[model samples]
Target chain A: MQKQVEIIKANGEREFFDEGKLRASLLRAGAEDSQVEAVLRHISKELEDGMTTDHIYRHAFSVLKDVQNPRAIRRYSLRRALIDLGPTGFPFERFLAKLFASQGFEVKNDQILQGRCVPHEVDLVAYNENKLVMVESKFHNRMGEKSDVKVALYVKARFDDLSEQLFDYGKARPLDEGWLVTNTKFTENAIKFGVCAGLKMVGWNYPEKGSMRDLIEDSRLHPVTCLPSLTKEERELLLNNDMVLCSQILDSQSKLIELGIKREKVTTIAAEAEALCGR
Target chain B: MQKQVEIIKANGEREFFDEGKLRASLLRAGAEDSQVEAVLRHISKELEDGMTTDHIYRHAFSVLKDVQNPRAIRRYSLRRALIDLGPTGFPFERFLAKLFASQGFEVKNDQILQGRCVPHEVDLVAYNENKLVMVESKFHNRMGEKSDVKVALYVKARFDDLSEQLFDYGKARPLDEGWLVTNTKFTENAIKFGVCAGLKMVGWNYPEKGSMRDLIEDSRLHPVTCLPSLTKEERELLLNNDMVLCSQILDSQSKLIELGIKREKVTTIAAEAEALCGR
Candidate 1:
């Protein structure tokens, strides 16, 4: 019998290390099976009792950087990049709008929708012929900050208020769904409340099938911050110009030229963005 | 017409000074009309454009300390004293339970009640023959921190959940009402949402009637921390021992003795507490 190794999580909780969870995260980042096995082998050699998940992530990231394509390496850094889209949180909302847009929904960011009692400035409102969804984005710049039950509860109430009133998008209709999206995880009670209240929620890694990560990957709407070719300031500038996704950069070549990027540097960035999104 | 004097509020917004508001606050502290006039006169003499409300409060508090009874002085310091009860926030909950109990309600603190879908650990639940109310206390240690719409929304949801299940509190009954109480103020939107959602809310100075301040004053449930006789540590010790109300200390002399107070000092403390509560 093998002894289970203990590891410290980012939120200061200690739990037994799970090899399957690590392998799954690696595989989700599009790492090849052979590369994942090598990474796992190296991780097992370095694993010790009371090691932090941060330490594990850094080790895995370094291994992936060495063995994988820039695309996969960028994908591996998705969580960190999502967090890096913050400090203002506007970019994350724009990113969400784009994510929904990619799924055949006409999205509007920061719309003032009239509720039954008061006006609510919803973060993103996405609608199609079939459904209208109101999303509230809870963006936390710091790690380990989970969207709690209060956020879920308030979002439910806000959506309920809006559901009582009809709004004209393509035609006059009530809100079909309310969604709570965050760049972090949701607390257990928050998830429970969301389920009981019949509100849709998407966090960084919640709900087995379709989380924020799954949706982002499925939509291929990678944030520009994930591009290794651009510096931090360059990425922020693009975000400030409302170009959040990698696809937006491909569409807006003039934004880079306006940001004073040389033609050759622009080509490199465009190529990196294209490769990162596998476009 | 004379230009209105601009005053900076605690939350950093500038507004024209209203002497009537200041006068009402002084009167609420049980200040006599003559004493109130004197305070107002002094305040007016020293008033400057762009003076913070904090400065006005200090001026009023200083005057009240000079001319008012110990009870009035304590009431004048009530808001600050409430904020002082925190950093841990348990004392505030205990204080609230006592406040409700003083009104002939059977109050329990930190009870895990079964909701429709999950169990919720409510802060204070107060029940009488006619009414059962669940309270969620938002205790902020910092000034200018208000219990916002999110809090009211969650409390309403939580209470609604509990409303689905009957509780054995004297008799089997569902929750009759949900109240959101704060030691501070409520944001405008929070108040609107609370009203729209049918959630009863009590803040330090809200509703124009029957607020937390009104209830505290009417009940004379002055917290032990408001007693000028006790040192900060001694007050904390009482709070730690669950002797939140000054009336509790009056009922339990042994607690002071256990806290290592001398006989004469105990007499002084008791007398001060008694005078502070006018009991």
Candidate 2:
């Protein structure tokens, strides 16, 4: 009987603690007490037997996203939520920027908008051989009709905000193309909207059999900005600093690589380190 | 947009209709409407996005097991609920009984005990060479401490309510055992009480792997009685009269097999069928 009770207590406590762990994760991600409480309450009310912790995290994130200014919460919360949603949207955007750089397109994230009402963070801005492409991403189980309208708005924003002078004067050109990427089948209305807006819609389906990651790689985006110059003494000091930083970064990268994080992402970190240290 | 909306609407409506599938399953199994409705309400309130239709059925059935005298409800309601829960439990029990037969135990289900002040049906009964096991089964996440007391009381009543002759004869022979089986773990205090009362406690975490099906297989309890016999000609006539019914049963068995339902369960069903047909 003691053994039986111990087993039961252990099982119950494990369940209770698992929920607590999720709550702690949310807190660590800087969720407000009220938001955390609300999420936990919703979860408790809806919980049935056999629910996985991952399912709870996804559900909580969805609920949080529905609330206003969810991004103001901890950076990790947003990242964890994106991860829980799988490789899409913001995560995919970051992933694409790195993949494009590795493949050779001059890629920039959070590129400055010169004429916008406010400084806006565009997902990705890629320049290759005087041609520029602006890309936006949407992740959903299935793309609805409204998605096309949303993407069209993004394209219009990009075309209106970026510098037009770059196209004719500088080696780099003003963005001439727009891309909208999604994980599910797009509605016909969305397809027509994309065509009318002069934006390419990349949908992952059985026939296409490609993810946003693949498209980003194919774009061949790389970093084109030149590194700052340094004198001999300054360069030597910087090189020493860079070596130390690079080793540290490499150690972390090695761990990530061992954990099966994409090699392209690790390579991007290495490139950034190399540029900093004049390697 | 219209096509996408149409598909979403269609799938949404289909899910709505299928939502009551568990109620249909219960009604088919002789459960009452009020009982099934109460269970379904508990289930519907717990629904989450991306949950499968089959999950709802299993959940409803698990909840239904806690409701006493489920078959006392209106026949229509019972049938509806059974349909909702799926038509697997009864056959599963039969298979479990057969699997345990070789181990010298006679397993019985839905056995009414009028000896007590309030008549009730036992979910399972196993008579071994040396012991008579009275078993109650509840399929859910966690059985509360009170539920443990209830099982203990039931076991005590069952033992005490036996005829004096039978009790004396059994006493002269060997001691009988009682068991309470649940999908969830028991409270520590409850286990102590059960152990003190000499009743065996079985939970989801039994047999090291927390699978209910596995526990039934490992327990080695069998059916003491066979199905009612039918002549060969009568069996043939019945099969011919309801070929669709026969096929449906076969299909259900095949589906169970596909789901990795225990082989012992399937064999029990086959044995019961053979007995029913006197084959």
Candidate 3:
């Protein structure tokens, strides 16, 4: 058992907690950055004295929930809380993706494409020897009347984007199947709509529920880390490095554009190189 | 001391003491809601056993950055992370308002004027026995060449909106003052412009760091809380009660309108009652 830590609040009260697990969970969720350290320092400075682990978690999560990219950290923090309490439909799609990946499917998370106008970022795309599957995940407590329509739209959007056949990877092919993964059971109308649209629907059913843990164990995914644990100097270094890399990439791209090299050709060469390098 | 916890990765090895704190810090700032919880759960379920916390925080915050809201939760989350480690300009206005309130000044945070065309939401409006102050806070890593022009524009916007006639509170007369706070040291031109515009400028001069905190503490302004913290049942109860009250008020007003009642007379009565009730 991990020893509990106490946080002192502004009013001279002490809040005790077994925060090691929470901290570990945050680190696993990918929060390593200077900003995280700064936030923790602020918490320490603002301490009046007595604050509970739950209070800290709630406050921290609340603050972070408003951040630009909160999905991973929020999920990690919530999982820690749920594991200690009771589960909710928090990590519904992520859980399903892990389960599917464990069963020997190659999972590509957050695949981005340059859409006709804005960038189209898909949640998860899985490919195997037999087929390519595009999935849209939903973690709602309840699906309303329009939920199925929304899912159908998402499936259609993915299919349309994939059908463009832009990427030259072993003769670009159309999407083999579309899947909708929802935490709650779909409405009858949704199931019918999904079937009509030629999309597969997977609700979190009982048999799948029993095998969830095993599936998670089998699928080899990475853990996310929190950002607060870094020192000031370390954060500056990382930020500087990122800025440098971004600048370099931009500089290279600009040079290529200046040389009158067509963007499509450049992209093709880059993609081929990346594929050969196994990136 | 809190005991360190380790996460077991896919390779059956433990990754120890990963220090990703940015996400945790942002969470500490504010990200507490059911939607955030749902998103986090999705990310966690998709995780591989060995992933680092940095990856998770980056991915999560990135997703949240795209959400649309007047309060700019993404910016606030980033500001919190920055403040937790130390102080930044982004949250300077709110921080200062809190400090002023702690010092016995009556402070109003995010005062929204619905009558206005664009619904001007002032960052902080503060009053004391001798002073009525309007403050604008700016967060910048560096003082740009156009810094002075930006400040001038902000001051002009506020001045234009304010009613010229001094607010009369019976025997109490209003005293006017305007202030601008910034993270970086202001440019010489900016300082000159502020002086010309009749605005006092305060820059975070390192030794005076405590001054800002003091101002916030003195202001005693409370942090804003979102609506979702309460359970669905609680929210529904409050909402239903509010709807009933609004309906009653509307019905009474409509009846008065139908009975040859002048709009001015009805307004006067309501205003009088509100004043008497201190609402």
- In terms of TM-score, the best-performing candidate is 1
- lDDT tens digits, residues A123-148, model 3? 77777777777777665543331244
Q: Stretches of candidate 3 above 4 Å error?
A: A1-94, A115-118, A141-148, A166-171, A206-279, B1-256, B259-279
Label model 2 with its docking quality class. incorrect
What's the count of clashing pairs in each model shown? 0, 41, 105
- Evaluated on chain B only, candidate 2 has a TM-score of 0.38
lDDT of 3 by residue, B88-190 (tens): 3424454455456666778776665321112334567778777776666666643331244335434533443343435432224433776666544565655
lDDT (Cα atoms) of all candidates against the true structure: 0.79, 0.44, 0.43
Candidate 1 chain B: 10-residue stretch with minimal lDDT? B263-272
Point out where model 2 deviates above 4 Å.
Answer: A1-88, A116-119, A141-146, A161-172, A206-253, A257-279, B1-279
Query: What lDDT tens digits, residue by residue, belong to model 1 across residues A51-80?
Result: 877567656656765677755455557887
As a whole number from 0 to 100, the lDDT of residue B119 in candidate 1 is 79
**Regions of model 1 farther than 4 Å from truth:** A1-75, A262-268, B1-66, B69-72, B261-268
Better of 1 and 2 by DockQ: 1
Candidates sorted by lDDT, best first = 1, 2, 3
Worst lDDT 10-window in candidate 3 chain A: A270-279
TM-score of each: 0.74, 0.24, 0.26
* Tens-digit lDDT string for candidate 1 (B1-279): 223789887557788888887776666545789888887877787778998776676566566556767454565677777887878879999888888887899999899998876678889999999988898989998768988777876777787777889898889998888989899999898899888888888999888899888888878887877665576788777888888887887798777888776654455456555545645
